[model samples]
Target: MDTPTQHSERDRSSEPDTGPGERSRSSRTRARIASALSWRRVLGGAVAATVALLLFSSYVVQPFLIPSRSMEPTLRVGDRVLVNKLAYRFGAEPKRGDVVVFDGTGSFVREDLDANPLTGLVHGAAASLGLAEPADTDFVKRVVGVGGDRVVCCDARGRLSVNDVTVDEPYLYPGDTASRAPFDIVVPAGALWMMGDHRSRSRDSRDHLGSPGGGMVPVERVTGRVDWLGWPPARAGSLEGTGAFGGVRTPGGAHG
Candidate 1:
């Protein structure tokens, strides 16, 4: 009887030992899982913050690069400017003298008429080649006429005129003609007449006369008003409209 009772006691001790070993291994696995989850949460948070910042910058104040000499003497090639997206948001339309970035996709570039798979591929590859777009492509220019201003080029003394006032464009490039082409048009309401400072080198509203919109940019197509030049420390400055435009008044009963 003593021998059988002793055997039973030994069996019970062995069973308890197995239970502790199994529990120890399970505890280690749970700790590892918790550690992995913590790392996952940390990575997700960082990614979310980065995306939010990009969204804010893109929609509120985007940074744009001057990729061509079309705006030379004002915005040089390779200079980066900051566009204020809110400039026209709060019941304000684009004002004369404000440098702006607009969608020239359909207005100037006919390729925009049809979505080309090739163009998309080329645009994607442009950065790799370090090349600018061909002429009459998307453009960044200054606003000369807004809403109802009558804009004509080459007044009697070779000066651009807005609403019968001769505009002395000091912003015009040194030795650059005010306008090589003669144009006379009453800017349609709800549209803007835009031109580049380097008139000879730029193809702005002057070049798109026969196109669908007749060179007049729709108010809704404007992306934002450019307020500052932020790059090339030497060329950094605010882009103020020439005083010439100040004297010209908006046509009668113009809406703000």
Candidate 2:
């Protein structure tokens, strides 16, 4: 025979002693762990995506914004152009009449100066996405002559001539002349003569003829060719190479 207090004690001990507070605390701890893991996964994915984008833009292709109207009518201000970084890679060279982007340091500009690393990184990333203006040393232009070709402006027909072959530029801005300034120079080996489609508004090779490198952009400095216009839903199309320079001969007399 057990006493009443002993019976009560035995009953209490037989039942589970877990309290609501303890279960609530344990649930909260598990929730925190799950949340932490989720955040880590999200952060890791973001980092990987950024790295992939940067690498693709640096090596394969990049987007460039048209900062000015120098290439207007063909490339308008605010227009975004996709540049093919590998266009001239693997022993290929930039052809005449191709719209190219290059670092104009030591040619267009007196010197090549880099921006602060942090600022440069930010701006470069933005510019690569066509969301910001390119560096001052970067320029976009058409290749009029390349490597040992004789380039003369304003022939008898008021046209630009390359290697004695007159070029009929259909892409020039409406009512704009081939060149208002007179110039005659033979493009040096491994150099290029660049010109703008909007002759009146652009300062191209002719503007720097007296400067160092004779205003000729080195072939090595060429970044890429403009292959597509990718902005403004109303005006998006491929920038195909034209036959304007088809009749011009290569430096070594090879058919162009």
Superposed model 2: Cα runs more than 4 Å off: 1-18, 112-115
Q: After TM-score superposition, what is the CA distance of residue 251 in candidate 1 from its true location, in Å? A: 2.3
Specify the highest-lDDT model's number: 2
**88-198 in candidate 1: lDDT tens per residue?**
988998888878888776676665556677876566344212243422444689988887788887866789888887888888888887788898888888898888988
124: Cα error in model 2, Å: 1.5
- Residue-level lDDT of model 2, residues 1-256, one tens digit each, is 9999999999999997579988898899999999999999999999999888878988889999999989877898888899999999889999998999999989999773555878878988888877799988889999999999999889766799998888999999999989998899999999999999999999899999999888999999999999998998688889977889988888667767
- How many residue pairs clash per model? 0, 0
lDDT of 2 at 124: 86
CA RMSD (A), model 2:
2.8
